[model samples]
Structure formats: structure tokens, C-alpha cells
Target: MSILAIKHGIWKVAGEEVRQVKQVTLDSEFELEEIIQSNPAILQDNWLIIGRQVMTVYNTYIDLLAIDNNGSIIIIELKKHKTNREVVAQGLDYASWVKTLSPSQISTIYDDYVSRYYENQNTLEEEYYEKFRIQLEEESINNSHQIVIVASEMDSSTERIVEYLSDSLIPINVIFFTVFEENSTKFISRAWMIDPQETLENATNSVRDKEPWNGEYYVSFGDENNRSWIDALKYGFISGGGGEWYSRTLNQLSVGDRVWVNIPKVGYVGVGTVADTAKKADEVFFNDIDGEKKSIYKLSKNAKYHEEYLEDGINAEYIVKVNWLKAMTENNAASEIGFFGNQNTVCKPRASKWVHTVNRLKEIWQIK
Candidate 1:
């Protein structure tokens, strides 16, 4: 319904306007390590790692033992000052040992921890946090022990160990974060995500085929039944919550707002809020970006994404602004760029003519 109502994909209505967004947060030379250290997203309770000195022999006692928010224990082997390649091998050894813990054994470890681990030991004990951890782990892993590694870096020898262990076809993940100083700024940051599969997919898709607008861009919305299709789109495009989750929140939402929903099957959906009804229609107009004189051209009733009449040149009056507008930066990867602006919708190019019209045609996406 909305696809046909506002501007088409790439084009929008001219006289319609938006308030000029104040460039309030001027970009500054800040330390990335500090920024990473302060990132709220990474410090989630569900994925926090906890443990102490888990041993895998071979002159390697794990530096720390901790469960990720996911309830799997991470065998952390830290290297101070400079590290050797064998540290990675040690991590793999710990990973193997962690994979052998039984349900009862894992719970026992957590039981011994709750009262001794934190500042408010009573709080966790009272809440039966150990029981909760056990329950969560039970629900998460099926039969095998969940294992992972946490280190600042991987040496070639350890990298080789990881390769060997991984080649055995086990469901294990490796996480490495580095603490470094750049431009007089110290940063404690994860080198990147544990998975490289998605990054490779993104690179293949985003080459030369960039978004038309300099704003934000999103991927296609997904349905429960059509998971793989949705996943592929997300991997292939800069998509977030651009579908049902966004549409459902319209009653409580406005233009220029953003939301993130991590679908278990599809990863993350970054939806920018737009119009919800006839009341919002008046508010969803485009203010002139340039202060030049403007003219309005009424378009014919061809219900396409951008406009079917690019054959007629820039003849259309205005374009529709949807969940588009990606940042113009070096690499253009979402994880590799600076973020600013309303999570609200963007009018960006979709098809060839830059139609911002997203082809999200799920019935759940329709507003009442």
C-alpha cells in the first residue's frame, strides 16, 4: 500500500518537505579503542564470558574461564606485551577440553562461581543466576559442549591449530579482540566479528553497485517461511529491519526513527520508522536540500517502484523516501563506517532509476 502511496522508489514529491537535520554531532578525532571499550552493544549480559584458569595441559592454563552471554564457556588465553603462535594452540586445547564438559559439570562450575564472582554476589545468588545459566545452556546446546576462544591475536601456530580443529567439522567459533593505540588513542576492540562468511557475501554484492542516495540503505524484509531468501538479501545488501517488525511499530513510531531486531534465523534487521497512517501523510514530505527554486511535476498513475517513465528523463516531480540512505565512507561496510542520523526511513534508489521503493510486499507490513 505505501509503495504506491508516496514517492516511487527513487523519486519523491518535491514540495513535500522534511526538517533539516542539525549536524549536531560533528565528527571528531576520537580513539576507536576507547570507543570500542565503551560500546554498549558488545557488553550484553546474554553473551558475557566468564571462567578462571581452565586447563588443557601443554604448559597452558587458560587465563580466564567465562560463559558467553550464550551460556557457552570461552577459554580465554591472553598474551601480554607480545604473544607467541603457541598461544593459539593453547586456546584450541582449552576449546577441546571445554567441549567435553557435561551438563552437570557445566552447571557445577557456574554454581561455584555465582557467589564468588561479582560485587553483588548476593544478588546473583538470590536470583539463582547459576540455575538460570544451566537452564539457558540446556536450551541452547543439544549434546556437545559449547566452546570458544578469546585472545588478542592468533599466532600462525595457533592459527594452524584452529584450522586443524575446525577441519574436524565442529561447531566452534573463534573470537579475537585487540587492544591498540592509534593516533594517540588507545582502543580495546574486537578485530571483527567471528564469522567471515557474511562479510564475503557483502563484498561480492556491494561492488560498484552502490546505493543511489548518500543516506542509509536497507535490505528486503523477511517472512518466517522465506528465511533463506531474506538471509541472502541481507547478506547481499545493506539491510536491517525493513519489514514487518518496522510496520508493526508504526503506531508508536514516526518518520526518522530506527530499530534493530535480530531475527534468530536472519541475523539483524535495522528498520527505520516511516509513516503509519493518513495522519502521518502530511508530515512525510521532503524539504529541499538545496535552497534553489523548486517546481512540482505530477506523475502519471504508473504503480512502479521508482518510476516507469525514466524514459521521459527527470520528468517525475519527486521521489519516495523509504529505508535508504547509506553512509558514504571508505569501504561502505556497515560495521566499518561512522553512524549518525534518524533511524527513520530514507528515500534511496532501489532499481536502475534509483527508486527507493522497497519491494517488501508482506501483508503484515501493511498498516491498518
Candidate 2:
């Protein structure tokens, strides 16, 4: 898409209106490359630049390589003019090589890159853990990779090729960056030809090689000091806090949905069905052993603080009532290596890792 800038100027004659449109140009491809390399977040957030002009076994070079928050590798190729017909094939070639890179090899690439260009001396392992908020395992890294084609414009054939690849569940997309100039000021805007998140979901589902979703969700019960697994089990609920960023996603869980609960840094603690949609803690009620329904604040002393935040508004801890099918204490929480646990409080994860985590939990808990 083209970026147009409208100019308003004094008319040469009365009652005459004149509008001028201006176009901006990049003097060289290096300008586009430098801006992206310096600020990768402009393309997407939480992306750690792994390498640039990185050479492969075939003696070809990749424009840029990055890793995202989900520990997936990103291959970014840029073009100043129309994307070439061979760009798609070149991207696939780089991806083929990238898929075989072990975690150590990826780290070495990042380390060498930093030593040559960056000021900080942090290792890739440290940055990976920091960016993703989880430790790195060699086998777990690069389970899937994505291709991003960035350019000023793309020909119809190139667009069709990319769309065809994506339709086949390949994680590839084109992002167009348009430039505009007015009064010696420059502006750049971005647009994605295909929805990136949708492509990612398609890619994730394709990689899992699993059936369609069974309508169950995986929810993490976070901030133990504010919500306890014991209390959640006793009250038949799950909770989240630390503001709307953490708690807002809880709204995605609806009544009648199945939920598998996990405690971060621990393991899967319980599996349950949602009995009620999410609400502020004070509004949450659960049936006690005596068959009496009471607000969770009365059942758990720690939950009382959630009531205080009710008046504070928006920052209050949110609760979703659950009908526990089976549960274990934090000490006995079932865990295995490579178990899936996202930092989000609630999510409908379709990744194979989530499926594996649930299968393992079922076997450990002996759920029929």
C-alpha cells in the first residue's frame, strides 16, 4: 500500500484549492536495514536479534535472524524496492538451514554478533531466558520458525506465492513499510498483508499434527502470595492479579468450558470445568462442605485482600469459579520436563507442548 500525504498551501488565486502529494524514497537498502537492526521492536516486540547477514552452509546469507518470546526463530528478509521473484525460495532455503541449528549453535551466532557490533556482552542464553521468562533447553529451541518478508512493495506474483505458502500452514507473512514525506519531514507506516497471529495459529496447529481443539483451555494460577492452590481447590476457583494485564485474559474463560490449571515454576495442579465466568474476587462464591455457598473472601483469609482492590477498581484480582474434577497440592503437583506453562493467566493453547503437558498430567493423575 502507498502512503499519501496531503499538502495544504495558499491558493495562487481566490477560491482555488490545490493539493499536492509527496513520495519519500530511501537512498539505499542499507538505510532500511540499519533502522530495523537498531530497533527490531518496531517490527515486533520481545524479539532478540540473533544475527545479521548470517552465512549459511550453502554460502548464502540471511538478512536478519531473530528469536521471539515463544522461543521460535524468525527469518526476516528486507527489500527496498519490489520483492524479487526468488525471495520466497531464498527464505525457504534459509529456514531449512535455520531449523537444524541447535540451541548452542544459535547462541554462538548471537554471541559472535554481539561481540562484533553491540556494546553489551550478555550471552544469548541469558537474553533468551530473560526475553521468554523461562530457561532454555537445546531440544526445545526452534521447534518452529517464522518467515517475514519486509519490503516497500511486493509484486502480485510474490504476494500470491507468500499467500499460497501461508495457506498451506507455513508461518510466512509479508509486511509492507510505506514512507511519506511532507515539509522535509519523513514518516513510515507498516501493514501486514496477512494477519500474523492467524498465520501463527495455523502454523502452530499444523506443527502439532493433532486434531482440532477439544474446547478445553490451559490456565495458569499465578501470584501465589495473592492466590493459593490450596485455597483455589477449597473454593473451587482460579484467580489472577497484578493489574489488568494479568487478569483481563481471564474473561476469555467462559462457563461450561473445561480448564486445566497450572502453577508456574511448579506444575499442573488441577483440571476443572468452569462453573462461572470471571468476576471480581468479591463477587466470587463457592459451595462449602456444608453445602452452603459463600463468597471466597470469607473462605480464604488471603483472598480478603482482593476485596480491598474491588473499590480500587480495574486492579482488583479477578476470579473464575471452577468445579474441580481432580486436584493436588502444590507439593504434589504433577510436573515433567518440557511441560507447557505460559506466563498468561488464561489461554486456549493449541500447541503440541500444551497437549503433551495435559497427556502427561492425565497419566500421572490417572484420569480416565
Candidate 3:
């Protein structure tokens, strides 16, 4: 693929334009690694860096190792002077060993890495919870792993291999990062050999093997400081941040859909049926004990603040009404060492961990 930039000139050359596109080489693989290390968010929002230059029992080194919000491991390999086949083989070799790692062993690896590179930072367990907003347990870690090959350029043979592997339902991919320089300004662009979301769906479907989706969904209530869980439970609703990025997922729920509610740092607190789809907070109303209906703002102080904030129109809280069937205070939230929770405010989870979480919650709440 070719990248081009159009340069605008002054009045003397009003109708003329200059196209300058220069391919730039990174000073070294170390520099490329430093750029990715400083901002793993560039790869994806869900990825949390575990360590750089991780070592395996086989005595080979992994370029970078990370974990996504769903507790799946991500192994990233950078291509320097090696042939495409060699780099791909090396990544696969690391993944073979990674797949065998038990959760406890993975944590140990992360701990050792932290001791070496981040001595003053929190322990691996603490950092895991802080980054993902959910507790990490040995059994819940590394259910599956993904392999990412990073290179400045990919040859046709490498691209073909990547496509074959991804189409075969293997969780492997290639991400090409091109550095370009124009007039002393530098820019980096990225492209994936296979669409990221499509690859994930294919991998997920292969794993599911035709298993039907459970009718339930998982929802993470926003942090307590912004939206009160007590208010949510008392008023029979759930809310997300005042931005569309946070609240748009709520649109996936419709009236009569059942959802499991979780509080970050806490656990699964309630199971409820959607009474209505998402709406602006100011538009929602709840019935009072006196049997009179009042706008949510009039009932909950938090709702009043949300309403006040929504007046600006830029960041307005969004709410989804729910009819709580089983509810508990944060102190009694239902969670075990292996229960599943995600950073997403609303998600329809189909992973085995989600199944385990729902089954356990059923026993705890005694719901049919």
C-alpha cells in the first residue's frame, strides 16, 4: 500500500501542489519497542501491557506480552532482520508454550517481570485489577491467547500465510506499521492483514462450536462516584458515562431482555429484566412510594446532577430501565475467584467464563 501527503503552498503557487511521501526507517527495533511500550493503547483499548522481552521456559524471548480485558493473553512479535517465515514460526512457538501456562504460572511470570522492570509499581495482581476494573484470579487468566506479528512491511508470502492462519480460525494476525516523514514531521500508520473484529468473531465461533448464546447479558455499572449503585438498585435502572462511547452499547438491550449487573471492584450484584431500552436521564421517571410518578432527577440526588450535566448536551448520562429480580448491596455482590467481568459497560458475553459466572450466580440467588 502506498501513503501520500499533499502539501499546500503559498499564494505564489496557489494552483500548484506538492506531493511528498518519504518512507522512514525506525532507528532500531529498540526504538519501535519503546514507542509501543509507552502506548499499548495504540494497539487496542482493551490491551494491558504485561511485560516486554518476556522469556519462556524454552529459553526463547517474546517481544511483548499483554492481556486483554477478557483475560486472554496477547503475544506480540516484532520483525527486525529475520525472514517472515522465521518470525511467524517464532511467534507460534512462543504461543505453543503460552497456551500451556496455567493462570498461577502466568501471574508468576508477570510478577517476575514487574520486579525487573517496574519495581516501584504495584504488584501484577494489583495492576491487573486497576487496569481492567475487575479482580484477577489464577483460573480466570489466559483461557486463550492471540499472536500478533508486527513489522514495518510485510511481503506477499507473509501476508498470505497470515490470511491462511486467520481464516483457519487461528487467533494470529499481522499488523504493519509504516513510518512516514514529511518536512521534518513524522507520522506512523497501521494496517491489519485481517480485520480485527472479523478475526475475533471467527475465532469465537470456532471456539463456541455451535453452542447457542445464553439469553443473559453482563453489564458493568459505572464507578460509584459518578453513578450510585444504590440509586440504580433503588430506582430500578442502570447508567453509563455521559459520553456516547460509554452509553451507546446500552442500545443493544431492548424491553424484556435479561441482564446481569456487575459493579467494578465489587462483583455481580443483581439480575434484572430490561423494562425499557436506553434513554436520556432527564427523560426517565420512576414511581414514588406515594404511587406518584416523578422524573428520576426529583428522586435521586445523583440523577439531579446527571440532569444538570445533560443541560450542556455534550456529556449527558444515559439510562436503561430495569426490573430487578434479585439484587444485593455491594458488600454481598456475588463473585468467585473465576467469575467473569469485562471493562465494557454493556456486553453480551459468550465465553465459558461468562457461563460459569452466570451458573454460580444462579445458585447464589436461587433464581430459576
Candidate 4:
């Protein structure tokens, strides 16, 4: 809670010799809002700012409106240092209005926000996929929402109300941002009242009413600048690369695990059983069209998997061999409303939508 520093390798904590940083007050709540608007990542990553001073049907305006990768609307309200319980009540008021918004209305709100702020930006759907690396399903948009009350600090009453609401399965929270001045330089740090990931999980589960995971994994086959989905279909494998975060999830697959692969912005293209655990790109060999065994690096010139980081342990591509039960080209990929999606390369989706997606895919692919 306190930012302290040592000068000349000598610690000072007593009397006039103590070195302390001055915590300063922000010029205005608008100044805090400007900092957040310019960089939404300061609040959270994978969020797209949809509106500023967003108006409600009740003739009130929300401080900032955003949408996360999961398509849940994020209502960010701002206040100066030490906010009161009224802000909590106000946040609930705004959420009540946000909960009833239809998909078209959400799109229109984004359009207005763009027209007023960003002159050179894509439409809602285009920007959503670009930011999240997954297509936006209209039916899933705004199915749930979160309220974030940000201030320099929260008073006891406000914190208590937020905790109660969050504990009751309401996706609401408070964030504290403190500004400090040290030797003519200003720095800002942030903290949350509750663990964000815990809040998100509780919110998602409560709103989605997801069923138990059925032991199947969801794979996002991001066949873009680095890898090729065509090569994957031909080679009997799935992959991820460019960074550890991208490739590490493939390690979750083991021999005999079932996986359903979805190509980002495309559709569900394959369902298969894992034939092997993950291996590095150059280490994975497949029999080519010539019936000659060759490394993936050699067989698929177009993919050039992790060419930039072939030998780099952290960034190199990783592959998991699969035996397809049924697979299709991108042109024949199956897509429909309400299918489960995630940015992770592999996840055990427990949402009801995932169950529906698998059942429908079984019928479409005639896979029994």
C-alpha cells in the first residue's frame, strides 16, 4: 500500500531522515477517465472500449462502456478518492439498463462511440474478432455484464456493498488507482478489491448456467500469418506458435483425448482424437505425398512453422498429432449462432453453448 525507496543503498525509516513519496490527488475524475480511455489495458486486457459517457434509457450516462473477449459488457464507473455507497447503488442502476440491451442496440452504441471518438476503425464484428482473435456471436453478446467502480480509494460502506453483491454472484467490483509523486515524476498504480479472475469465473458461471464439462477440449486453430490450416488438415496435426502463450496450451493434449478445433474467425473444421503429445515443429515428422517421411519444417514449406524462432525454446512452434474422426476444408466449416468460443488455444468449455455446439456438429458432420 506504500511506495518506498532507498537512496544511496541506505534505508531511511525514522525521523527527518525517512524518505517518503508524496501521494497526490488527481486534478479531476475526468483526468482519471482520460488516462483509462487512452489505455484501457490499464484496467484490463482483451477489452474493447465501446463508448464514453454512454447514455442509458433512464437518461443517465455511464462513465465508460466496454466489452471483453467473452462478449460480456463491462460498465466502468469512475469516482474521486473515497467513494460512498451511492456509487454502488448507481452501478447497479446502470447494470439494470445494460442487462436489457439487445445485440442490435449494442452494435448501434459502438457505432456511435466510433463516430464520436475513432474515425478510422472497423465495425463491431470486425473489431471484436481483430481484438479477441475469435468471431463475435450476436446471440452471445451482452448475455452477461460486469460493473467496475474505480476510485482512488473505497470507503468501508462502498466496499461492503460491493463485496456483498459480488458474493451473491453479481459481477461487480471496485478498483483503486493511486497517484504518487517522487522527485518531480508522477506514477500511477492500480489494485482491485477482489481477485479479477475469481470475479470473472463467478460471474460467468452464474450468468451462463453452464453444465459440467463433458471431458472434451476446445482448440482454437489460429491459422494465420504463421501457420496454415490446410497444412494441418493434410499433415494430421494441430499447432500453435509465435509465443509460449500460444503454443503452451497444446501440451494439454495427451494421446486419446478428444478435441474439436475451431479456426478463429472461420468455423469448427475438425473433431479428432489426439494421437501424440506436443512436439516442437522440427521434431514432428509426417509422411509426405511422396510417401517419404520428413519433418513438418521440411514437408510444409508454406507453414514455415515458427521460422523466426525455430530453435528458440520459448517461442518455437509446438504440434500435437491427431487422428481425425471427421474434418473439412475452410469452405465447408460449420458455423452457427450460440457456439462456445475462447481465446485460449485449448480449454475445457463448460458453457451450455459448448454442449449444444458439439451435439449440432455431430448431426452436421454425421459423426453419430
Candidate 5:
């Protein structure tokens, strides 16, 4: 509390002498965006992408052109003093222009940029061309996309850009970073990249703000008592496996026939008919499953389908509608086939149980 005590406290805190190694400079404190700006390898050393500044396009040359490891162009807009919300529009503009370029045009752009820098950058063109050839063969290069925003602080430039992008329904990210000051110590620095949207969403609003969940919640009013989801489930299952041999082929059922196969380990496999005939390929798709691709298949006999499913009192009440809400509660039922799985390892709730469960939810919600 005294002056002498305060001075002693200050001295104690600064007791150590500044070391010579403290003067060494390093870029370790830069965020991902800034890192890429200096050394593109912050991503990886893939030639499919190269960092460059465009001479003829938007007055702004990009901080990084993070192309796909193959050829899909990933336009990166980096901000050192700003945030992504600042440059999304400009980045989008560049993306639009880049998308319009043909393979030849793209090569020319690369060549043009190259010619200015490399004496014989024509060689880079061939290498890129060969890489593109491989990418096409591998079924890559769907489209060039992806927005990146990086900065230690989101300034007015960043906020303006983010608001505009959000209003335009442009899916872009605002990567916030905490830039640290250099300390008189050995080579060590720290920085961070955080999602700005998440931070904003978590912040309290002064007036009427929207729900934090956004649209991720159920679109259709979730009526815990509604039996409609049950009906939807029953209709989902197309029954009638033709025979036993069908289960072996994973399609022992003929087209147009709905068959359920019982896997002792994984439960029943169901497939609905999309075609008709012995050779007709099974649509083999699932009705409703999440986190997987579920498909139904044609079968020979409904017995084979039921053989595995029917046990004890399960089929006693016809199970016209099951308490799917209950089943889901008992089990992790966030998937399309939250109730069950079809072939292709996809989830397809059993027709009877699925429908019944849906209705049960309606029942609980008392909607229908």
C-alpha cells in the first residue's frame, strides 16, 4: 500500500534482465489467414493451389488462392487489420470471375500471372494441366468455392463486409484472431482463430432477438402427441419379400416387391420396389434415415422379411402404429432411419413400428 512497497512490487515483477534472444523475430503469432499470406504452406504444399495477386481483376489481389489439392479453386480472402466480414463481397466477385474462365482461360490466367513472374512459367502450365487431367479422371473438381476471413480484430471494414454478406445470404466465415504482442523472451508467440458468428450469436441483445437454435430446430411444429409421424412411418415400409433366397443376394426380392431381411446381428433390412422384374435393379433406398444413406430393396417373400422381425409379442398387436417417440427416446433417434436400418447400412425405421411410433408422437402431442 505504501510508495516503497509499490516500487518494490514493480521491481520484483521486472526483476529479470532482457535477454539478447528476445530480439529474434518470428511469425508464430500470426493467425491462420496471416500465416497463409506469408507462407502458403500454412495449408499444405499442393501445387493445385498457388497464392497470387491478380493484375487485371479487382484492385485487390488475394491473400491466398487455396485451390483443391487437385483443381477445385478455393478463393481465400485474408485480412490482417480487418475481418472476413470486410472482404466477402470482393472475394465473391473474384470467385464469379474465376468461375467464368474455361480450362484454357484458367490456364491463360495462370500463364499470364506466371509470365510476369517466371521467365518460363509455361512449364508450370503443363504441370498444372497434367494435374487437372488427373483430377478430372478421379472425378474431382466439382466447383471452386469456400470463403475465408482472417484478422486479429474485426474493424468497421470487417463488420460492414460481414453484415453485407449475411444479408446477401452469402455463406462466408469471419475468422477472428487474437494477436499477441511480442514479449521479451525466447521465440514464442500465441494467436487464435475463432468463429465470429458464434461469438455474435452468443452475445446478449438489447431488444427482441431470435432464438439461438436458428432453423436447426424442427421446422414442422414438433407435436409430441401427433400420430401423423406414425402414419408416415407405416406408409414408409413396403412389405412382402418374395422368398428366402432373396436375402442372400441382398436383393433376394424381385423389383416392385417390398421385402425385409433379418440380420441376426443388425436387425431387419427393408427395401421398397422401384422397378418390376427379376433382373430389375433394386432401388435399395431407405425411407427416413439421418447420418447415412439408407435404401430399400425388392424381395421374394414377406415371410423372410418378417422372420427376423417377428418375435414374442412384437407382432401381437399388429403394431399398426408404434410409439416412435418412445423408441427414439429410448434410443438415439436423430437419423432418417432413427427407428431402424436398411441394406447399404442405412437407417430405415421398420414400417409398422416406424408408423406406430410416429402416431404415438402425435398422440403425445395430441395433434391428431
Candidate 6:
């Protein structure tokens, strides 16, 4: 993508009158590596770089190592003057090593990296909770991994190969970064070879050689303060808000989809069929005490919801209607050992734990 500057009511190159901004060549791939090391968000907003130039069993160094909120490792291998095929192969090789890593081994790797890179640091578990606000599951770490090939550009053959690997559920992708220079300033733009969301979906499917998805979704209902679980249970709707990220996943719920809602630290509280797609807080209505349809935001008992609704100018509360198969208050919620949980507002989980959880909940809730 080209970067253009609008100046004096005319679109032109950032630095020049009529010429477009020119792409600049990095002196070395290490320069690019350092940039990403400083801020991995340029590649993925949710990723935390755990190791830089991490060494493998074969004695070769990986360009970078990162972990996402889902506890999946990311193998980032820079092209770095290597041929496209070579970089792809290297990334795969590193992934092979990464998949073999146990939770303890991963912690050791992080300890080594921090000792070498930072003056002081918390344990990976602490840092992970601080960064993602969710406890890291050691057993779940590295259940799946992704290979990332970073390059300035990819040839047609490289692109085709990447596409084929992605199509086959290999969880591999290429990121192309272009550097532009103008007026002694440098700018970087990144583009993914395949849509990252599609890649993630493929990775989720490929995880643990799992069985097919059971067409059910997991919803984490953590906003009990703003949107009361009692209110939701009475009103026949699930709501999320506070930010776009918190509410965006609600879009995945459509009419007739099966959803199992968990109350984060509480437990599984409800299983229901989605009755309607998501709507804004002001647009969603439910029967009030007098049996009159009233906007959920105007309900006095849900004062926190109304407060957040009025204050969240950009990302207002969104609610999805649900027809309850079975619902319960938090006091009556059900949970046991090994129940699947995630930080995402909504997720189509492919883990074996998810299947087991759903089956167990069915038995507990007496759902046929």
C-alpha cells in the first residue's frame, strides 16, 4: 500500500511535490528485527515477544519467538536475505522445535531471554496475566504453534506456496513490510499474505489433531458488574461492552447458534440458542416489571449498564438475544475440573476440553 500525504488541499507524496513516496531498503535485517523486538504489536497486537534470536536444538537461531493470549507459540523467521523457500523451511524447522517445548521448557527459555535482555522481570505466568489479564495455562501452552515468514516482499512462487500451506491448515503465513523514507523520516507498513483471522481459524482447527467442531460456541460473560447476570437471565439476552474488543466477538453469534455462556471465574451458567443478532444497548428492549417492552439501557436496576451505555461513546454496550435452553444465577452455576475457559468474549473452541465440558454441562443441566 502506498502512503500519501494530504497537504494544502492536495494529495501528494509525503515528502515530494508530485512523486510518490519511495520504498527504502534496510541496511540489514537486524535493523528490522530490532524494530519488531522493541514493539511486536507491529506484527500482532496480542502477541508478547518471549525470545529474540532463540536458539534451537540444531544450534540455529530463530529470529523471534512470541506467544499469544491463547498460549500458542509463534515462530517468526525473517527472510533476512535468505531465499523465500529457505525462510519458509527455516520457519517450519523452528516450529518443529517449538512444538516439542513443554511448559517448563518454555518458562526456562523465557527466563534465559529475560536475563539476557532485561534487567529484571516477573515470571512468564505473572507477565502473561499482566499483559492479557488472564492466567496462563501451562498445560495448554504450545498445544499449537504458528510459523511466520517476514520479508520485504514475496515472489509469486513464494506466495503460492504460502497460500497452499495455509489452505492445508498448516498455520503458516507471510508478512510483507515495506519501508518508506521521506524528509529524514522512515515509515513502515505491513501486509499479511493471508487474512490473519482466516489463518487463526485454520490454526484453531488444526490444533491437537482434534475432532471436528461440534457447532457450539463458548461465551465468557465477565461483565456482571455493568450487565448483571440476573438481569440477563431475566431479560433473555447476553451483553458485552466497555470497548470494541470486548464486544466485537458478539458478532459471531447469529440467530439460531448454540452458545454456552460461562461467567469467567464463576462457572457455566446458561446454555441457549441465539434468538437475534447483536444490537446496541439503546436498541435492545425486553419486557419490564409491568410486561411492557423497555429499552435495556433504561432499566433502573441495571444502573451500571446504563452508566456504561451513556459513557461508552465509541464502543457502546451490545446485546444478543437468546432463548434459554437452561439458565441459572451465579449462585447456582456449575463447574468442575478441566472445564474449558477463554478470555475472548466469544469463541468457537476446538479443544477436546470444550467437547467434554459441553457434554458434562448437558448432563448437569439436563439438556437433551
RMSD of each: 19.3, 7.0, 6.3, 6.7, 19.4, 4.9
Tens-digit lDDT track for model 4 on 286-348? 998888889887877676787889879888989999999999899999999777766567766
TM-score for all predictions? 0.36, 0.71, 0.68, 0.67, 0.35, 0.82
lDDT score, candidate 1, position 279: 20
Task: Order the candidates by TM-score, highest first.
Answer: 6, 2, 3, 4, 1, 5
Q: What global local distance difference test value does model 4 have? A: 0.81
Instruction: List the global CA lDDT of all models.
Output: 0.34, 0.74, 0.76, 0.81, 0.36, 0.81
lDDT of 3 by residue, 247-300 (tens): 767877899999999986688899999999888888888889999988676777
Q: Write the per-residue lDDT of candidate 1 for residues 1-368, one digit (tens) a residue.
A: 01011111122234876333221111321332223223423422233333344344455565555543233454444544325455555555676676667656665555555545555444322333453322243543312233344444455565555555444433333455544443454444443323322221221222244444333233333323212223222222122221222222233334563332223323333443342221221123333345432211121121221233324322211222334222122222222111121121222222221222222211223311
Cα lDDT tens digits, model 5, 18-118, are 42322333354344544554554343233244445654365667655644433455566656444344465666677666656555555555666556645
Best by TM-score: 6
List of clashing residue pairs for candidate 3? none
Q: Which pairs clash in model 6? A: none
TM-score of 1: 0.36
List of clashing residue pairs for candidate 2: none
Per-prediction tally of clashes = 51, 0, 0, 0, 50, 0
User: What would the TM-score be for candidate 6 when compared with the true structure?
Assistant: 0.82
Minimum summed lDDT over a 10-residue window in model 4 is located at 1-10
lDDT: worst 10-residue window of model 5: 1-10
lDDT of 2 by residue, 1-368 (tens): 21222222222233575554365777777788888888886787657888989989999888899987556789998864434667777888888899889888888889888988889978877878776556666655676789888876777788878778787778888777767676777666677778665455554454546455656687877635577777888778888865654677788787888889888778888998889888888777777778887877777775443565877557788888888889888888888887876655776666666777778777887875
